[model samples]
Target: MKVIVIATAMFLAGAASVQAADKVTFQMDWLPGGDKAAIFVCLERGFCEDAGLDVSLETGRGSSESLTKLATGSSDIGNADIGALMAARVTENLPVTAVMSYYNQGPHAFFTLRGNGIEKFADVKGKHLVTSPFTSSNVYLPLVLNDNGLTMDDITLTKTDPGALNPMLVTGRTDAVISWITDVTRYTRQVEDAGREMIVLPWADAGLVMYSGTIVASDKFLAERPDVARRFVAALLESVKYMRENPQDAAQAVNDAVPELDHPTAMGSLQDAIGLIFNEVTERDGLGAFEPERLKATWDRVAAAQGLDADALDPESVVNRNFMPEN
Candidate 1:
């Protein structure tokens, strides 16, 4: 009887530990893809579980929609663009704050064939450009043009469905397409099949320095579950580090979670996107560090694009770095 009681107590303790794993809903700012491999890798490869978290994933259409979800408590924490968060803070005082910088540079870029007349930003003048109507990239288009010594008047712009932008560019229907570098492989594949090489003129290289995909959370989540939030951030950064070291397994994790996605395709996406996370800026500032000057510059551009007052946001108020773990 004494031996039986001991075994039963041990079993009950084991069950309790299992139940104690914190449940977290990680909202995705977009659908599952190579760029989104970080969250999926963490969940599928057991990083979140290792951190004592029972994480569930959710998909979103865009940063604006994801911000709405976070603001209303429909979700807890997710990846979003810092510029979107800044705009939201100005338009609506949402409680969401970015905790860690993910992509330290903006992914916005113009893709075209190298043989095309639009090899440089200055070359975009008097060329036909295509872009999707709903993308946040549209808001910053004017600023990119201004930096290149051009304006909306210089280019004949077409707003179309996202699916059609690349086709237009590759088929020579348009001279260039404004898109994100995250889709480099996808666009490359399409352009290659068309017997042309896809050339990406990234806005970051052309002077649009700002923070993109960042870890954002509702204020309530931070206040109510500080430990879980901290653990999640640590696990997320760990996943990114893992991705850098093991690109194959990291990309495979995405297909493991969403089997509809092809493995090689996802791998291509991961290869193109990994640089956005672990580049010169990351090396200089360290992972997830948002320098004061860059943060201010981000707000300045966001304000100019959205026509919001620069003083509308302090630039520092939209972020809370307390959730980031110490080295």
Candidate 2:
């Protein structure tokens, strides 16, 4: 896939038709992908504009960088896993708070080849595992390892780039790599084209539950620009709704934003993303409803893994549901 230049005429027409509003900068956790459909959807479907927000969604190198950008005020808003924020708070006391979680369930996982003989979590013991060395992965891997009666010392943990995970596994450099279930859809074609089979070990399967792709803002900005932040979250929830109801349209919207996504891959990715984002939410309390019990549970898990006291902190330490959509 290649980046395409969207016609300036359309943007110009849209700009001409809409009045200028408070501009908000949104930094993504990574480059445009299926997990980021809500951001692109908000832009493509004019949800941000309708909410009186002039949103600029920029690509980030990773969660660490995105969080840094948020903390340093380089961006007004950002998206990342809640665990990422927790680790940051512990490591450096970064005052970032999740406003509303997009994916209530964590999607990150250990991906492997089906025929590679890694059919279960127990098989991960003593295996050569490739993973991001960031705090989020650092905390998650050990938790998973401990859950399976193993520790980090039991496996061969190699520090690798997120993009290099599949190649390392395919070439026998690593047995498995940390990834998101979204990878199955986005990189499936590339993995197949490389003649490799793929299998996903979802975190959900291993009793590892956490929030993924949450919209967060630094405390300073949330206090200074609460109106804009609230509008951003409101638009974000609307975008989530769009992705859930009209997945094909959401896919096309994401393809429009990313441009490198070809038609076939984009369609398949849209379907996969729908499953990733829309699961359980529609049947329950709907999108962007921050569940206090789930938030507390995730916090306790992270605290236990990090050897911190969960009782010392409150839900306010991790989440701020003040901006979530009304039930």
Candidate 3:
């Protein structure tokens, strides 16, 4: 009787272990794109499954909603922009931490028509521009304009959805749009199909560098499931490496998952976006670990625009390096 009871206890323990490894959810800030290099590759290659994570990828309305979901534990993990996260932390005591930053480039920028005779930033002084209502138009865009001897006063800034941008530009409803470079690439194709052309000015040109698509988790998750977080980051880093090695295949995977992104367009946009991915952090400090200098640069740009003290923000509080893989 004693031997039979011990056998039953061992069986239950094994079952519980398997159940524990069966689930995870990854919320994306947007539908799958080249920007989602690591996460998309991991899903396509089975790295997450092999790591014992049954992952689900859900779309977020935007970064703000994604981080909210993560903070409230509605999702296990999600991508966020460091800039948005910092602003939130200042206003609300957001209970979230960035485990890794995927895009070294923040992916925000201005776009223009090729034949507008406006090759230089100075020409934007009197142009019509499109931007999202929620983002840093009043804050960050001014810095770019000021840097070029222009300001919001210099141009007509139009608030529009990304879907409306292409039509607005093509129809002359707006002169240009401030948007993601990938989105610019999509618009580029639409314009080309309509016998027009566009130019992409990366955020790097204006000195407002930031990390986009950071992996974030709830504070509760960090405290309760450290091991699982570590595994997720490790698998993500592996996915990044895989995507870099197989850019064409990775692009195809993204196209397959996001059917709205037709094949040729997806391939071109992926090729354009690959340049924005920074391998520097992964090669030097390892993935997901916090870097103070980069954080400081981000804050400095924000301070220039918002008149906030750069030193007032605590970089360490927003980033947690404990879960990153040790080299």
Candidate 4:
């Protein structure tokens, strides 16, 4: 199997020689970093080339922003939170659909410095917490708080800017900050720079289990250029598999493409991110394949967290699995 994968990668690496590539613009959910390594690996390692795709990377502010771009046909495909897609689909009737399951588990978590009072999810009670107002994690904050036997009133919460969340945590301006676990390495380095240790309390550990990052495409992009979408997904899936097996190479790909991003931090971020993509849920459902029960479960959680009517939209309608490689 290993030999077959290597041969396939090698074969794809040489594919750009055979044909004219299809240009596909890939919108990002956030700035380039280690957690975003799969796309970089796909581009840097020539997986996109092998699949006859010319993928262009675009920076985005948040999932909702990216989804808006995708729905409006400003972008072809991109990564966004599936829950955001779910809620957006129900309320706004956005013409965007999730094409692949990238992070099978929720990436929301609380980051706090060691000396601070927060040591566990329950420890957050009576503490002041900060989060970027635009993050999709904010929608589920109440559910997580309620699950830990607390409520929004139990903790003093502040909506800080994304760039300031970590600096404030390291400076002790707030007891903790809500961010995705994918930022673990980047945040850990920052905390170390401030001469303080950091501790992370994952919300999933506190009973918030659901899908998070996923590959979504514009409805028109999928409808008008089905073959191009198929090729991009194939390349992306291969890139994801290769990234998991070679974190160092994956990190290097991110750094080599984005020169300002240091290699060590990128490597650490990729390692932390791999935990989200390849885990117990992935073990049961396989890569890029969304299981029916889990789909229902994710929608149930998203609906409960965002206070949406579950009956308004079918969970399956938000995703289309026809592009998963026919193994």
- Candidate number achieving the greatest TM-score relative to the actual structure: 1
lDDT of 1 by residue, 1-327 (tens): 999999999999999989999998888988999888889889999999999999988899999889999989988999999999999998989899999999999889999998888777789988888999988899999998898888999999999999999888877899999998888999899899988987899998998988888999989999999999999999999999998899999889999989999898899989988878889999899999888999999999999999999888999998888888887
The 10-residue segment with the lowest total lDDT in model 4: 12-21
TM-score of each: 0.97, 0.83, 0.86, 0.91
- Model 1 bad stretches (over 4 Å): 1-7
Evaluated at residue 59, the lDDT of candidate 2 is 89
**lDDT order of candidates, top first:** 4, 1, 2, 3
> Residue-wise lDDT of candidate 2 within 1-327, one digit each (tens)?
122235566677678767558888998988776557778889999998889887888788778899999999888888877777877787788878888777777766888877777899888877888886663656767787777788888888888666787777777787888876666766566668778878788877787766666788988889998888888888888888887787778878888877897545656655665665666753575666667777777887878877887766675677887876566
**True-structure lDDT of candidate 3:** 0.75
Give the Å shift of residue 167 in candidate 2. Answer: 2.2
Cα-based lDDT at residue 3, candidate 2: 27
What lDDT is obtained when candidate 4 is compared to the true structure?
0.91
Worst 10 residues of 3 by lDDT: 281-290
Stretches off by above 4 angstroms in model 3 are 1-22, 136-138, 255-262, 279-289, 303-311
Candidate 2 Cα misplacement greater than 4 A, ranges: 1-20, 90-93, 194-196, 261-271
- Pairwise TM-score winner, candidates 2 and 3: 3
